[model samples]
Target: EGGVGYCGARRLKGGHLRGGTPAGAGLSYYYDPLPTNCVADWFCLEGNSRHLPPDPLQHPGARPDLNLAVFYHACNFNCLYCQNWSFRKATFSGGKVSAASLAQAAHERTACICFFGGDPTPELPHALATSRLVAAGVGRERRPVRICWETNGAMQEAWLKPLAASSLDTGGIIKFDLKAFSKEIHLALTGVCNSQTLKNFAALAARLEERPDLPFLMASTLMVPGYVDLEEIHGLARLIARLNPNIPYSLLAFYPQFYLRDLPVTSRDFAFKARQVALNAGVKRVHLGNVHLLT
Candidate 1:
């Protein structure tokens, strides 16, 4: 295990690994160190991050005064409606930073470090390295820093454990974008198979009982007008319920973006129906995100 590992599709020569190598490099589109309101509605739910106190020990929820949103550039999945697709150009062009500097950006006021992107799969090594640094540097008096990942769940099986370990240790959540359940639908929408995503989600679900008080894994599907319909919702919800019904699932209202601009916004009726389908499927906690986008 010490001599071999992976970062994205590239394998690392672990024995030959050194500082400043691609294995330890992270390319972020930008860093938002401000404590702005989180865009995800479920994150603000009661007993989550709504009213977190400065003292980690006193957290009724886990909101930090400052959240560092580290937006990476590369992604493994090429979804047709990627909202952050424009930034993907930076994947190879520029925007590289060291894990230490990124960790240092999390000053005393910063309480959360969220790694998202096009998707974080392509840059997992860098994110993990940065998280290690951030974790080690937290002082006793400083508030607990939560490490969260908003990913496509396409990473290899080996990386899933470490990703979940970091979240469970820090009281953060892993939000998997379950684009579609049906293999055919998934390939059509994301230009890739959904097998890896589904496999990785189930692999992580096996660890859910380790931490029951705080939700360790969460799933969300963008209600893409005609593509992600009732059938897709039903299948995905059933999968989640089967794995662990307690895992919170969110149905996001899709806004036409990128190549899928012709489609209309998710309708209000559809969003409500999707929630019902998930609830009926045995999921105890379900949420509707971006309700404003619903027509």
Candidate 2:
């Protein structure tokens, strides 16, 4: 029980070893310190300057020009349409990078540190430790570093606050990929129930008023041609709007890939209709991503 147990798609034991330290973490394969306009504008939420580096004069690299993208190689969901499915192969392959090393990568210029992968739920200890390291490294001139998480939102209830606190204290946003609303459809697509995901999302949304200037939580759903229809979007949107209408919702166009390769790309007509439904459901801001993927 102490070493190696299967947690969904990830092997949890040696997975946390990094740099020969027992508590060391790993599986982070890439680190990019450059800016990507490809990065979503939602990240440009106002009032973020309130959480800027401790001392800009001392930390000259404290500009928001770059976003440190830390890629992990594990996930809890088995979504048939996972675009980043290749991360599965690296799950147990061994690339234990120390949390300190990863934290160092989030230098002064890092506008934000985004933790994502197949999804970051599986290897959260490392992410949290690394986030703490990053925050501490910034020192106490003001707030913590902006650390964002693009996750499946299936993390255990115990980890929710710490994860949310990391982002909340640092002016970061947690983007939850709400795959589908209906139990049957969600189970079919991701092989996991939507209950935990939805619960975690609502729980985090409740804290929105804590930081009104910056969006505390955001949601996105992939428009998987035949699977995620307007109905699913409508239902999901209603849920979000009911909890907090102001929460930013992004409707992503899906491309045929992984087990869902037989399906066609999300159509432009469908994308527009989905947005209309979400807005009508009372979601204040709705964005469409991967428009180029629209057929």
Candidate 3:
């Protein structure tokens, strides 16, 4: 029953609380000041092409560049195959950053700023504040800066709508990493139920329909060899198709990492097969992400 409450003025030591009840029963959520090792990763330049969205790759006219600000460890889930598992070291020890200074990191070449991490939901206040500053051109001389998020999609609904609205206005994208469709398998993979994720995905898809021009929502799933199979992919695809077939679905190749290191890397054959399954399920645009990771 212990959960986070959404009061704008309520401040934690390092972050502010954006209130909402836990998506999972009996789970308690907490806020920490935003801790990050902000770095600009170039891979975002190649946006998701399989899904028709307004990304840097699609809009060449606007500066299609981005600054990937990786937030430090602080997630609601305990995913076993976390590739960026290093965040554990900094989850609580990393230096905290103010919203203003963090927003200032978006330089002239940066057309958009992506907030990702162990997950950004825990630091929603900081992310929201930083996004506001960027949109308002706090330090960038009134230049428009797009806001984007790569999240697990389990945040309270109270936080999700505002974040979605920010992305919609700036021609940005909200990518949800839908781990699994089955509740049991989802809990096994991420130590949480998939119910909130599925619910949130449906909510965002409805929001996308309101904005015909902007590709407001996208979804992805990691193909973790033995854990995530073709059957799971098909089920996920059907769910997405039912919401909106045009919603882009990406099947990512899994690499051995963290507790799942014993598992083999996702094979190219498996990735392609899953893509076909998704396509057959009526998802118009399906992509195989991290192709290079395929063995």
Candidate 4:
């Protein structure tokens, strides 16, 4: 009885508010002391950085799919509710890497690359070089690999065209996250208008039309307080449906993680409404995040 004595019954609170690793009192994520690269005059060559820990979901055993996460540092967009804020800036470590080495490190079952923060578009030149390396290895074996390029979708066509081309034969999965739909709301949430983003999406649509076999997924997300709008969500759904009904839309719940800490998290009701609105607007697969796991 003494050995089996029960401690007090206790409950932990706030999993929704606690996924991201805390930094200092003010900083959202802890920034490691990264060494700067000497040659990059335009941007700081901060070594690879993270706000939360590396996405554990990417590791081999973490998911049987053998997925991986490539965290690129620095970003062109300044999304207010960004969970991975520190990685949103240009850092030497996160930008360029051995794509070949990465592929060499990957297994054949790896379906997801989980391309993530700092914006990957700027690293395209490096990514191209890296992809060639990975392609040399996995391409020979015909592995079922996909490049999950998570982006703000604000980069130019030149960059995207190459990326699109790379994904063509390899059957890579390109996932883009448009911050917001309307120009004003878009600018408010992401700190820039994605007119270029919309254009890039149109091009992607045209490309997918031409190549029905192309593997691509266009998605969008809205930050909680500043940018959630039915009209915008509906507009995005309509645009994607007009392009392709099978297109999957991911409706994420925005929490006050980064600069938007002052704002309350997007309520569960709001998230549900957003998903329904997307479905009503004709989107096929709208998955919501941030709430506790559903029963």
Give Cα-based local distance difference scores for all models.
0.78, 0.78, 0.70, 0.56
How many collisions per candidate?
Answer: 0, 2, 3, 11
lDDT (tens digit, per residue) of candidate 4 on 1-295: 1121011111134432211111101111112122221111112111122322344445534422344556655467777777776652334222233444544555555443545565666445545555565666654334435454667777777777777866664655566787777888878777787799888887777676544543365575753654667777788888887877666567766666787889777777777878888888877767675455221
Query: 1-295 in candidate 1: lDDT tens per residue?
Result: 2332222323336546433333444355334434443434345322244354344554444334567788876677778999987865665453468777887888766767788887777777778888888999986755458888899999889998889988888877888999999999999999889999999999999999988877778998999988999999999999999999998899999998999999999999999999999999999999998888899
Q: Which residue ranges in model 4 land beyond 4 Å of their true spot?
A: 1-64, 88-103, 107-111, 139-144, 209-215, 293-295
The better candidate by lDDT, 1 or 3, is: 1
TM-score of each: 0.86, 0.86, 0.79, 0.69
* Global fold similarity of model 2 (TM-score): 0.86
Q: Residue pairs in steric clash, candidate 3?
A: 5-19, 6-19, 14-33
Q: How far out, in Å, is residue 272 in model 3?
A: 1.3
| Residue 291 lDDT (model 2) | 88
The sequence of per-residue lDDT tens digits that candidate 3 reaches over residues 1-295 is 3333331112243365433112111111222221221111111222432343454433354543444444534677889999877766654452466676666677656656677777778777777777787777744333456677889999888887798888887766788999988898999999899898899899889876776655678888999988899999999999999999988788888989999999999998888899999999999878777888898
Tens-place lDDT digits, model 2, residues 1-295: 2354333333335446232231554456444444343224545442234434355544454444567777777677889988888877876666667788888887656667888887777778878988888888885553456788889899899999899899888878888999999989999998888999999999999999999877868998999987899899999999999999999999998998899889998889999999999999999999998888788
Stretches off by above 4 angstroms in model 2 are 1-22, 29-40, 46-64, 140-144
